[model samples]
Target: MSVRAQLFAASLSALSLLTATGALAQQGGLDPAKLGLNANENLRALAGSSNTAMVFDNRYEGIKGTPYAIPRWLPAKLALTSNIPVASVLLKYDVYKQRLLIRDPSRPDSLLLDANKVTGFALTDPSAPDVATGQPRVRQFRRFAEAPVATQKAEFVEVLYEGKYSLLRRYAKEMEKADYKGAYSTDQRFDELTDKSIYYLRSPEGAVAPVKLNLKALQAAAPSLAPALKAEGSKRPLKTAEDAASLLRAAEGQ
Candidate 1:
């Protein structure tokens, strides 16, 4: 196991003990001993791990919406750059900051995994099903060095429909600072995380471009696929991401 993997696995053993003293606790109550590592190495790895050291008091205190892709942490499968594979990782994606937050049972504060070292990651959303498949939605994300749209700000995008003409969901979030200007201001008092996701469509020639979740945008993204989009989209409402994915499938299949 790699150094990072060892640290992540060993943190669970320290989770309960740390929480007993109110030092730090894992994101979710996960069993660390299940990792089955040498006791001495576990301690060593725990000490070597980086604790965020940055804790916000009353985190998200009175915030209207969360700054995470998913408000709660989920088990994720991460693909690291150096062939390091860590399964069942308890982590959260902070879309606002584009940071990968990892939970360490041993630490007082959650650790932030270096997003740069992550080549790709997969998250499963229990509520949503795959657009093309009936199975649960496995939202996969990866960083593209060169993209059809501006990716400098947000590096990772959700792969929705991958085919000759692929569709991607670029998540964008902005913290709407609390606008409570004294007691008389009519503005909202709590901070909010606003979602402004941008969609992209990739051509067969391998050019990805931003496309809105509508027939017009899809057609504009690829003039050649306009007829197919019109015929298929008219049959269904482009109301959700799944609808858009279905439409993309039609265009690609035709």
Candidate 2:
């Protein structure tokens, strides 16, 4: 095969794998207990009794609006609590509204899972590319809710790095509006959807505290490892969450 043909074949193979994974997740044949759930707990009971599904309306008035985040339907395992059975379903995270949307097997429409009820969740997608390495990435997100602290509210934060001192990423979204003037008239409308990735540090004492994505913030969070982190940052540019994770791992001597 030619070089272009080889590349196209590889792309097709990757797409096929992703499609199969999504189909399996949506069809719901996977055992919940095997997915890290308590075997004795009732799976159907934990899924709740609600039949109403939340629909995402992308049309504002008559105009089509863009989604706040890339719409990804992935296989996910959700835990309500240790006592309740973990539910395995196809879920989508709405970064715009900070909501977990689920397509229940019994429901025709997508339903919003209660954020407060969710203890944690894991999403797996095989189609994404790794940020650090330019290879095909099986993206996995493991997030858990922490108790509200004085500085931050209780919300699901993704575990970026876990050690004596851990790094977490929190996602928040806000709507921006502006006045759009047409040829005939003007009207106020949503200009864009803005999202923020806020990083936090979990101390060895198990307290969670917010930290900015900067070397100074990392140093402040771990005063003992300040000099080491600064050295690491000097070696390589610390510009993203992945860079921060690399720094943390180095500082911890992992």
Candidate 3:
């Protein structure tokens, strides 16, 4: 056979191997090592295994409603700190499940990083508009390893006001029955999205405690700033997370 024909046959065989093993299906076209995941060597190994459950799949087409934190998907940077070198990667966060997802160009399937493996992350999206003042809402989050609130598992908590006394917000999402039924069937089986938020206070004494959403409870939590909080509450009651954050800032003399 001619040399050119032999070369062509070898190329075809290599392509067939890649296709059968699914090696050419990676997304994002980046290596996990570049994403600061040396410690997760096991996870990378599992990606190549025949067992499919190890791979993270984001295509949920069932009755599950939207699973994103924001109405729109915003580009953000994720930071992870571990025995491996600290690395930052462009990723997305699903606020509903509180999971970090990434789409690697090298793989056709996306991967979900274990929350426990992440130290913290930040969103680069422009500040959201506040519901009350129509101003941009600026918030940052950190992994609260020892959160005293009902969210027993340590996760990201928004830092509302940071000072001698700090206020934080924990967001949660759940699914509920939709008010309207599916158009195709009479069975009222459709599901709707619902969210829940809880606020907490971290005092100088190192106590992280949950604060109720009422004026009375706010006052009880911070007796020293009761008067100031009450004054702010009179102007704008603590009916929303932004309101609570604003009140905390006022108490801090910001």
Candidate 4:
């Protein structure tokens, strides 16, 4: 095999080991007893629930940097028809190959969106108390992804927010019912439930196969994983799915 191929194999091996260690730690499944009891149980609990099956074929892209800049090709294809303030849009494209490469912070790139291009839109509230003055607080509805020319891949509409639970619920509900007419033909693939669970599995050649666990296990491990979680908090320490993925990627790299 070529040197490139060997590196690929090594990365896969590391990924496999990371997954295996995670699975072994979750052998007993999501145990409430393991995580300290707290009133936030509804948010933290993930035991004895229906096994939510996920299609692993989903792709992801890493959108990093302070001022975000999405590729015109992919972002133009995402359908943002929901009439709600988008909290955060989660795209699952392959980040390794398609990281939205950050430009010079002093001279960041910008993509303009025409009225016809977006399905919906919103602007940040200027009247809102200045949490971080001088930081650009404008919010806009941008595209996320599109279906292949032949395949019927669904476009996900993620709502961005910066408020408490009531505000979250209000916007989430509006997004759940918004009419999404994107590259994808149907809404069957769209998920509206804000509190759904998902999981992933990993394997490496000639290595021990590992079991699988979902977000529940991570939540179960949160209280105990406080130290790790706290130390890594600055680098997106487990608030969002993308943050959690970053944490896992960092751990796997080590």
TM-score of each: 0.67, 0.58, 0.57, 0.20
Worst ten in a row by lDDT for model 1:
21-30
Candidate 3 has a TM-score of 0.57
Off by over 4 Å in 2: 1-70, 82-87, 95-98, 104-108, 127-154, 181-189
Which residue pairs clash within candidate 1? 15-105, 24-108
Q: By TM-score, who's the top model here?
A: 1
Per-candidate count of clashing residue pairs (backbone under 3 Å): 2, 0, 13, 13
Please provide the root mean square deviation of candidate 1 (C-alpha atoms, Å).
Answer: 21.3
lDDT of each: 0.76, 0.69, 0.66, 0.34
Best by lDDT: 1
Task: Write one digit per residue (lDDT tens) for candidate 3, span 27-88.
Answer: 54546454345335434543545655666534333465566655543444554576465444
Prediction 2 global C-alpha lDDT: 0.69
Candidate 4 lDDT at 191 equals 34
Which tens-of-lDDT digit does each residue in 37-111 have in candidate 2? Answer: 432223443444777788974535442344423366777877675548765888876765667888867778998
The TM-score that candidate 4 achieves is: 0.20
Candidate 4 lDDT, 1-254, residue by residue in tens: 99999878866865665566557558956454533233244333323256667666332222222222222222122334454443332222212222222222345463333334345333343433333465434444332223221221121223232211000101111113323347764533343323222222211221111112323443344334445534555565355534454454443442
Model 1 scores a TM of 0.67
* lDDT of residue 11 for candidate 3: 67
Where does candidate 4 have its weakest 10-residue lDDT segment? 163-172
